[model samples]
Target: MKTLYKNYINTFKGLSDEIWWLALITFINRAGTMVIPFLSLYLKEDLNFSVSQVGWIMSAFGLGSVVGSWIGGKLTDKIGYYKVMVRSLLATGVLFIALQFLNTFVSLCIGIFIVMMVADAFRPAIFVALNTYSKPENKIRSLTLIRLAINLGFSAGPAIGGMIITGLGYAGLFWVDGITCVLAALVMIKVLNPKKAKVLDELKNDNPVSVYKDHAFLVFFIAMVLFGIVFLQYFSSITIYYKDVHLLSEFEIGLILGMNGFVIFIFEMPLIKWLERTAFTKLWLVFFGAVLTGISFLILNFTSWSGILIIGMLLVTFGEMVAFPFSNAFAIERAKKGNQGEYMALYSISFSVAHIFGHNAGLQLSAGIGFENTWYIITGLAFICAVLLFSLNRRLNNLKKIQL
Candidate 1:
């Protein structure tokens, strides 16, 4: 037992202090992610919006995220990641407060859009920070640490947020979420020095590289978008499905979602270390992730029991553990030294675009057709992503030879 515990500790050893601080920042920021998980419910129940209206509002958030990531990437290169992160965190907190006053559909959409644009800007900036701080070989582990922080905080946030919602309503959710973002901003301001976080001299240059020019990466980006379309359903359509179809309460739903974070928190670090030592290539890991993700949702079709939801979430968490960090490492590897922000920004865009495409499209489909049919569509899409990622194994194998 002692030896096993020591080995687990060693799995996370060797990362820089900057990486640890960044992970801490992620934990602080994600811990208050109360608004988003409950947004669909707020829009549907409190505002009495239809499924399509909720979709439109959610897409607005996605659009903002897209814009924020693009601009954040540009700014991180021109200014620095620390500045972008600080500004984004502070601004997003303010917007969360503003959301409490906006009640109309159009107003809510506009409010959510601005809030998400500011909030989601943090993504690329943090990735750029991870790249700048960690050694090339340690990139995956560094990123996994960030995800670990994220999931750990995610595990806490929703369970707490569910209680807050029960006690004080949506206004309380916004207030708490806002406060947490501001706190994260304060931490960034005090801890992250922009001068120190700046790009290294040899890697620093003014010239910009267009991500679209890389054919291989572009194809990979497309596959990720498809993957995200299926993956992000947990945030958008699945919550509604849990309530409307399964008749679960909000607390129960949060528990189910929290299980995703719990499972990731326990297994991600060790599993990633294991994968690094094995014959499995990065893209193949992603292929298996997609297969697992598909199977998780597919299980729901066969079983409506509450225990099945936990099983499905566990499978989905395992898939996320395998795919996301490695995929992030791939994008960072693809970047020119000076343009890490742009490369990661492009990667973040896949997720943002997926949110826009998937949430809106999935909601419409669910409302028009049915939830079971939606799961079928997601299952098919996941397999398609798996095949696409599999085709890239040769290229990815060649990439492994190049030092990131």
Candidate 2:
């Protein structure tokens, strides 16, 4: 046991200093996000909003994400990732704590939406930071580790937040998240302060937005946006579905989500390697991912709590694990040098865009028809996304590689 412990420390020591930094940042960001899954419940049960009203409010962050993605990337290029990240963290911490005080639904929505804008700003900043700081040869490994850290946080967040919500109510969850956000920023500040974290003047002639023109890149990115539309069942719709339809407790809901993170921790590295060894390039895998994800939703429509739901979520996690890093990797690979931040920002658009599409659509469909019907609609969107992704794979295959 002593030998094993020392070896574990030594192995961690061998990792790039940046991995530690990323892990800290991700832990902080994800832990902060713990409150999100519970917020819909809070809106309905605590704040007295109808389900439709909750959807309208929840989608606000999606709008904010679009702006955050563009601006955050630019800021990363201009001011440096560490500075921007630290600032975003500090601001968001305050915003979340403020949420504990808001009683009105509209006020609560605006405050939470603003916090999401700041929180998502970290998306572009940190992606650029990691991609910039790590050596090119280690890019895939570094990204995989980053995802692992985030999943670890995801794994912890839901379980802990669920307990807090169950015991202490929604306000307690918000406070816990608020404290973690500040703590995470502190760990980041103390653990790693790369030179890039230093102050810098803006790059006036920066042309980061040119990412829009890359056809193949656009296709994958667009597929991500469409994929996100359906993924909200995990965070938004599913919580309600589980509570209302299945009559699950907060702890049980956390267990359902925790399963995804646990799988990611155990399997992500092997999955990434398998994806590389075969002709399963990111593009093809993401296309297949969409189909799997869509099928997973269909499974949910038929069965809510059974072996099937577990299997469905497993498939959803499998698709997500495959597609997310692919989106990041491909966007960075296809981008021009010196403008990686911009490309990643464009990539953030998918996640951000998906929030709007997924949540609002969930609201309308769930309200107009029913939750099961909403799954059918989202599953169709997922299938359409897969088709689009397939077309993109072919396009990239046919195109001559630009020698950037």
Candidate 3:
């Protein structure tokens, strides 16, 4: 027990203070992420929108994210991450508050698009910040630490959000979301002095390669989009499934979702630390993670027992712990060879693109083909994603050998 405890503690030994602060900021922001987990329910039950309409609005949310990621990437390259992060957070805070007022379909779509555009701009900028703040060897662990913070906050967010929805309604969610964004920004301003930080030198390449032209990276990008599509359903269609199929309440659904975060919060850092010390390549780990995610959804098709929900969530949580941090490290490493901001932007955009397709497609499929078939389809996509990542891993290995 002592040995186990010591090993777990060792996982956090080397990350910088800036990285810790970054994680704290992420925690503050994500803890108030009450609106998103329940957004589909809000539109369906409260606003009386159809599933199809909900899909479209979610797609609009993705469109905004794509644009935000692109603009944020460009600005980070030109002005630095510090400015981009502060501005994005502050703007997003105001937009969240404004978002609660829109009731009509067109207005809600536009409002969410604008809010997400501003909000998601923070994604790539923070990635760049991670690069600047972390030591080279500790990069992946640092990513895991930040993810831990996100999950920790997420664990709290949904349970609290469910209670808020039960008591004060969805409007309360919007207010809390907006306030947290503003608070996170203020903390960023008070804590991080970007001027005093040491920026790492990019890998020496007199002729830098554009992210658009990188064949290996393009393959990885496609895989990430597929992964995102499969993973994002937990937020969209899965919640609906929990509600309609299992006849769970909003608070019960929140607990199940919160369970995903809580599992990751406890297990991810140690798991990541152990994985890093192993001989398994990062992409191989990613491939395994993808397979596990596919299986998570596949199991849902087998049982209607609400108990299975916990099991599926556990599988997905472990898959997430294994997949995301390594994927992030891979992207950052690739970015180091060229333009960090642009590379990370494209990376963020891959998930944004997933958002564009994933939420809408999952909901539509659920509405059209029924939830069982939708899970089967999503399970198939997850396997396809795993195959792609496996191919990309081999391709990268071949390229490395050729270079040697």
Best by lDDT: 3
Q: Report the number of the highest-TM-score candidate.
A: 3
* 161-239: candidate 1 lDDT, tens digit per residue: 8888788887898888888899988987787776565332225657756777877788889889999999989888888
By TM-score, how accurate is candidate 1? 0.95
Better of 1 and 3 by TM-score: 3
Q: What's the residue-level lDDT of 338 in candidate 1?
A: 35
Instruction: Write one digit per residue (lDDT tens) for candidate 2, span 113-191.
Output: 7877887888888777666666665556567778888888888889888888888888887777777788878878887
Can you give the lDDT of residue 342 in candidate 2?
78
> Could you tell me which 10 consecutive residues in candidate 1 have the lowest summed lDDT?
196-205
Question: In what order do the candidates fall by TM-score, top score first?
Answer: 3, 1, 2
Candidate no. 3 TM-score: 0.98
- Return the candidate ranking by lDDT, descending: 3, 1, 2
Residue pairs with colliding backbones in model 2 are none
Task: List runs of model 2 lying over 4 Å from the truth.
Answer: 1-15, 196-209, 401-404
lDDT of 1: 0.86
Query: If scored against the real structure, what TM-score would every candidate get?
Result: 0.95, 0.90, 0.98
Candidate 3, residues 1-404, lDDT tens digits: the string is: 99988988888997888999999999999999879999999999999999999999999989999999999899988898999999998988899998999999999989988998999889999999998888899899889999999999899999999999999999999999999999999999999978766555334456768998988899999999999999999989999999999999999999998998998987999889889999988899999999999999999989778898999999999998999999999999989667888999999999999999999999999999999999999999999999999988988889889999
